[model samples]
Target chain A: MSDHAKVIKKHHDHHAHAIAKPGKRLMHHVPLAFVLKKVLGHGGRNVNTALNLTSYIDFLLVTVIFLLMSFSAGGEITVDKSITLPNAENVEDVIEAPMVAVNGQSVMVDGTPAGNTRAIRDAGKVQKVDELFELLKRKKELWSSFHPDKAFPGVAILQVDVDVEALVVKSVFQTAAFAGYPNISFMVRKRAKAGGGEGG
Target chain B: MGGVDVGGGGGGKRAVNAEINMIPFIDLLMVTIAFLLITAVWVTNSRMNANAQVPGPPNTEPTEVTTPEKILHLHIEEFEFKLVWQQGSTVVAEDKVPKQEQTDKEFVKFGDLAVKIAEQWQQHGGHQDPSDQKTDQCVVHADNKLPFRELVGVLDAIYDKKREQNQADGTIKNVPVFNMSFSIR
Candidate 1:
């Protein structure tokens, strides 16, 4: 609808008062008139009007597809906007576990800042990430308490940026490993197509 | 395209029977398509389970390490990947592969690395067919300059299911990644 039409329609909020009396006959003959009034807007703007339904449908379809693709994607693991994960073809289903996200500057454990990536880099040596290790250790202990009979499943997801340094990755991995988590999952974006690429 | 009379007329006037009401059908079809596409996102883009054993910190009691002989160590440099194969107390083999860009034709740099990894696996006490063994861990020591994308590309190629094509009978094999862990300084 044009902006002028929208403005006029807003003023005619009570379109059901008098002019819509004739619309009842149109509605009885064509149920689609009611549908169009509900979906498109009110005031019964020419029930017999021919519209380019193809383009309207195309627009709705495209909007729906984009919304569906990204809406609530992997609720357990939020697709971090800051980190660009590497694309990989061989991936398994996501396991619900403590996730450690390492971007360019900092390391966040389950969305909480656990350690400083810059500090680790400046250290110039492979040092234990004490903050991350303690968080993971607490998590492990909590899990063990919950399941007294079963062993604590030590699974963690490493959602690191593709451009992150290897030293930072290694530090996080070692911290998680030492904190009693052994089974690690690398969070990777599924490749759009399988081809003869670097697996790149 | 059957339609009903427009004004409830029965005096032999022309009925609105010539029009096909395709708008409602199109609306229904598009709504269904939109619904299915949105729900399927939850099931896609999962994790790569690397049941890996990373080399841990000092001053802590160490866990059981993989046998020295069976370790396949890959050291990543800016442009070179140094691969060392250690079997039993001695280093069995050593090789280096240059990094190739994604646009490299016929063979990218990772393709060569995948082939070398297979050859090493076959020679280093693998089954008569390299495809038979689906359990092998690779320890990668990467430099600070190397991007994680390059590392993962190599890792994906190493464990690719099709990497076992050098078999005699020509049957495809499962992936050959028992665990893939990174090493520290």
Candidate 2:
């Protein structure tokens, strides 16, 4: 073969070898001394260099699904901070209605402060509080206006503190009844365990 | 996983670019996640219904009495609970559970009182009436000095006892034993 032809054949062979073995081609691009030094420096062990975003996203999806499944759907009543509901074994959830919260000091009707609990208690052996009755009466009137044809539903929720006087609670109940809210419900917290009664 | 393919070229490597179409899938997943989150919040704040009846106005007319029905009255005092079973005006069985007898060690006694009350109720044929078939009404008289927790405890005891009996009898439809109304007397 001629020298020019031989030189061309050698160059073509080198190119083909480089293309066929990409790892060797890559090694050739980087210095062998540098690669050896890195290997020795890291004790020839493979280091995790990339983050697996797919696996991370998969974990997050699983957590979200679990949270969604565990949640219970029911009517919610925003309990006031002043009232600590009595814990009961067989207590059910509160329905959607106007709430009358009685704490140690004051009574709140639908988040509005109606009167002091002590004052209401001190007002003799009364079955109703005038301020609370007025508030409930107003609510009933509004409800009646909104649904002109329908009768007043008369449902009201009483979220009372566990340590409050029973007479005070009774007064609230009677007052609510007299104000056209005859159906009264006491809101309570459900105990964690069934058939087990915990002290307040 | 991602990859790039080298296609045919003149002595040069040509990459065939490929990409995942993740926009639509990700968008759908995001929407679903958002919807699930909102639904979860709504579900967690669920409520249950409890009903109560107030005293009606005084009636001037007297009504004739037919068959006398059994009445169960539970009175919650400052440190004790009194359970009274009555048939019309006659007292059948009465029990008093003190706070001292309601300890964790003595809790069984508290429950036993409920069992005894249930037995008395059954003996008096309290469950036989057609009108009382599904009803378990009781008058709960609570003192002003009593804490609400004790009242709940007493109620729980009665309910638990009734449920236990019903389960033992293999009743198909189980109902609450004490459908209660509160009174201050």
Candidate 3:
């Protein structure tokens, strides 16, 4: 073969070989020494990939702060489901004390069942409820024992249903007074504004 | 651009492992939101206290008896509220306020009654006594058949303070006029 023809044939063969193996062409683009260094630098261990938790933690912290601010730290009285309180615009925060709940058919003192309201009313003119008096007296004694130096504050909280008659409420009040609770407070739902307000 | 090729160039740089596990994060947020919602409801239902001092037994008697001070009494009935002003044992003035008629709901009207009480307070020289810094005291006697709401309305009427707004400066001031207590008749 002539010298020029042989040189062209050799060039074509090299081009065909390069096209057949694309990986070899890519390897030529990157240094083999650099690739070996990267592979060996990792020590053949898989790198850990995980979700970034910083944002989630920040959100949780914000929520916790909001909850703490909203929490009512003052001793909150648990109201019975049976009693519905009257709404008042001007009232103060309640202090910690024993609660006396007077519902439609029953009365409970500190969540303990005192007596049935209807039975007490029907039991021939009850000026003072015996069961409630006993319970309150017991509570007072217990409190007195705990605070030997201080006198009983005689403070009691009354949770009476708005639908209950005034007479029944009066009896409960008198009974609490006779049991050494002279300073009574009524638990009321707070109204937002002054006159013509709705219950909270 | 000159970095080592980790894999054969069949595809471009292998897609990065960008998938973030979201199950736990979503669960945490859901729980926090639920807790906040529950506490918000509870905060709205917090209780407010209204105090009443029960009349105790007579502790002591004055050695020298003098004329007793005048007292204002409020009598609450099912259909009406009666106002009685007394000095010692004599009744000085009396008035009655009837319930307003309503078909849809029960509403107690006390604006007129409040004006009358204010007038009586003025006539009695209640604001004149410097020693009496506090408002006049009122005793409320509610009927047995009366509902608690009605009684509260009567008390509120007697004890509600008036707010006077200053036009010159945007400020309001409370004019405390009465202090009240309740009793069952």
Best by lDDT: 1
Q: List-wise, what DockQ does each model earn?
A: 0.32, 0.26, 0.22
Per-candidate TM equals 0.64, 0.66, 0.62
Q: After superposition, how far is residue A24 of candidate 1 from its true place, in Å?
A: 40
Q: Where does candidate 3 stray beyond 4 Å? A: A1-71, A123-126, A194-200, B1-66, B101-135, B162-179
Chain A of model 2 scored by TM-score: 0.66
Ranking by TM-score: 2, 1, 3
Instruction: State the lDDT of candidate 1 residue by residue for B1-185, as single tens digits.
Output: 32445656457886644667877877776777767664655535567666546344475666687755477888877777788876765877888888765632221226677667766766663434554544566778777656677767766656653344244667654445435777767
Query: Residue A86's C-alpha lDDT in candidate 2?
Result: 63
TM-score of 2: 0.66
lDDT of 2 by residue, A63-172 (tens): 66786676656524578887767654545555678988899899899889887889866764646688999999999999999999997779888888777877787778
lDDT tens readout by residue for model 3, B19-38: 45567766777787787666
**Runs off by more than 4 Å, candidate 1:** A1-76, A192-200, B1-31, B37-44, B52-69, B103-109, B125-134, B161-173
- Per-residue error at A172 for model 3, in Å? 0.8
Residue B62, model 1: lDDT of 69
lDDT by residue for model 1 (A1-200), tens? 99999888877798535545443433444557656566545755576856656676677778766676567654545767898878766666677889899999889887888999899889877778999999999999989888889977789999989878777877788888889887888888765434644221
Best candidate according to DockQ: 1
**What TM-score does chain B get in every candidate?**
0.59, 0.55, 0.54
Task: Report backbone clashes per prediction.
Answer: 2, 6, 0
Off by over 4 Å in 2: A1-58, A71-76, A123-126, A148-151, A195-200, B2-64, B100-134, B158-174
